[model samples]
Target: MPCDKSANADPKKEFFIDVITMDIDYPDCILDLIDNSVDAYTRSEIDDPQIRVTFGEDSLEIYDNCGGISEHDLLNTVFRFGGHVAHDSTDTLGIYGVGLKRAIFKIGNAFEFETYDGVNHNIVYENDLSEWKTRDDDEDGKWRFKVRAGAELDQETHGFSELRITKLKDSYKKMVTLDAKIIEEISIKYVLFMNRGLSFWVDNLKIEPLFNFEVLSNEYLQPSVKLLEKDGLKVKIVCTYNPRESLRSEREEGRYGWNVFCNDRLILLSNTTKETGWGELGNIAFHQLYYPFCGYVFINSHDVRKLPVKTTKNGLVTSDNTYKFILNEMWNQATPVLKYLRTSRLMDEETLIKDAEKSANEKVLQDSKLARSNADQKSIFSMNEKASFKAPDMKPKRKELTKIQYSRPTVQVDKVKRKLGAESNKKVGELTFDLFYDEECDDA
Candidate 1:
């Protein structure tokens, strides 16, 4: 038998657009643009990288102060679909190379790219794809692209890229209505980065991370930190459990649960996403898991092989064993603290205090057992250090002791040279006399 030929399954332009939008949410599409921004920043080695996502009435825009594309990148790969860039070899994000294009197509039928590198005044570039949105006859394989170069950009500053997408699809136009939702998503999605000085802005409102500490200052358990190391890679797990009452206030609405990160990028922010708590793939329910425990699993290694992130970089691959392993650890430590909280709540008033004390002791014992398997420094989370909720009631009894005093008799010398010893004496005009002596003086 002889094989006739090999064939390539090249997709149509429409199909390519569909593929990018099908599995993604609009918010995540915005994140794709940020991923490229981050990659650009990494390549340019820019300091104080800043990203702004604008929610416009008729358009959606994402702009970054990262270095603009170089001539090589612009000509060889910036606009090439399914193209691989040299930077991909590095550990920067957005490896698939179509994130920019996919995001552009998904958001609207028309888009314009404007960019400027800090140097090379003649290297500015812009590509307007407004006409391609209506051109259905040209197939993806035969379509061509030409980037138009322009003079110094309207802005005086160097090193910037601005992506503007307009002419939105009817349904996609609804993206503007997502300002409130995007604020929350960006806050959580980039909590790690924001806390580390990545400034993000929506419209004019700047996005900032929550308190930058590992544990809350309110009534919460001491953070449990565990570190796992194999070869040179490290994964850290830090967790804490707070009573639901602490979060009962409206301000704490979306602050409960896990906030997982990979190489300093937040994948899950505070378990706001139900997938991390209770969902089809999740075996644990938020309520059933005691309601207010959050764990942060961080992969210190930037190596893609060790980092547990889905293609979107917004979540972990639930099916991956290592991912599941981290989740399991989070559950294992969190379950006890939550159970303790629930148990304390359900106990009868008469037994609540005693039960709580007993539970605290038992928790410390369990933590001690866990401590055996983990090194003090390299563990994901340290086991519980005593009961975190118990308060001390000082109770020390006072001691009763007796005291004794001793005195010596004083010898008194009279002016006429007679000496006498007195048990008690007082001095009057240079003469020492006992109480009896005063009476004797009165008699004299």
Candidate 2:
């Protein structure tokens, strides 16, 4: 009893113990790495940061000229689990610490990293997954990567870091063929920013800029409607009808408008689909009449993230009040143009033949009246002193009317029904409508 049993208890047994086993799967590893590259490039304050992605048969390397990690920082923090030098307070792009490790683990079975700090010259870290399997089991598992002092390079200027991932996953190999195209598209998509001096290269291919819109001065003069404006956000609508072409035929007239951008960089180009609510209106023909062209509403970068973009990152402005107001303003301004397109499409059909025939008949009567007036003027001139006699039928005969047989409207009723059906599926509530009947009808 005098031994003080409580004081004799083992310190280890008295202490709390916690074991965490985290298993995360990374199916989209390469995509995550590319996003990380974008983050690193965008965060660096360098005038023009260069990001190089090289793909080889069994290895992949990504090198960036951004600030490199120090040897001590790398060992003590960078390689540690839950390590994030950049956190929520940081405005930098790569705040999530798990991205790099998960990216590396997904693409390669083994990976190595080399970073340069002016003071240390070069710090190297290598991780071989193959060796982890052979290592002895222990209370504290051995760290995944190896870190050591690296050969010194000249410290007069800042240097870059290189990440080499070997034992490449099969998907990485397929990406080698597509990397060039991806770089080209990315370059074009971000051309405006690219012009500001950001450069990205994949293998030997350099990305080139492709701008979508020309300068404002280059746009043609057309009636336009202004919709919404809040702070820096502005929405303008424009509609134009081409009388020379038929809008009803898909091959002739192409519908335009509805593009989404962030900071003048286009994120999604077109969002029209049958599944979308926009396709539902039977009055789309009326809408398209003004549709040979339409203008887009511009939302500034600050509010862009608020937009309802799909999981695929496709942004769409729906029939909500915000969009409805804009559409109403646009539709009011476009009513005339929409009528024009509808009339033009209608005039091409056989049902409008009666109207065409009436127009032709009016022209014939007008010509006859003109002829009688000319004849009376000639008679009056002949009565005047010694006027030369004029021929009665001197004017040329008008050409015979060419009977044009217009085809039936080819209404595409099924297509319209299918489109409406799809649109109805998107509706959240029930619908009610009133039916009108003739007073003379007694039959039920």
Top TM-score model: 1
Candidate 2 per-residue C-alpha lDDT over 1-444 given as tens digits, one digit per residue, 9 for 90 to 100: 577456533223112111111233222344345544554555466756776778787887887776666667676666554565553222222333555666675567788787775566544445565455345435564344666666767766665677888887675566534565556556544554466566767786776665333211101223333445544345544344222233245522122433344334444443344222244444343233233433333343233333433212223446435545444554555445443333323222222334435456544334334323323222111121321111111122333654333222335534543433323321201111100111233323
Residue-by-residue lDDT tens digits, candidate 1, 185-234: 77776666676567888898998775453443322224555667643346
Q: What residue runs in model 1 are displaced by over 4 Å at the alpha carbon?
A: 1-8, 42-48, 84-91, 120-144, 153-156, 216-222, 229-233, 243-255, 272-289, 300-307, 339-444
In candidate 1, which residue pairs clash? 225-380, 225-381, 225-382, 226-379, 226-380, 226-381, 227-378, 227-379, 227-380
Off by over 4 Å in 2: 1-28, 69-98, 117-124, 130-144, 174-176, 188-192, 212-215, 218-257, 262-266, 274-444
Please give the CA lDDT of all the candidate structures: 0.58, 0.45
Which 10-residue window in model 1 sums to the lowest lDDT? 415-424
Top lDDT model: 1
Give all TM-scores, in the order shown.
Answer: 0.64, 0.50
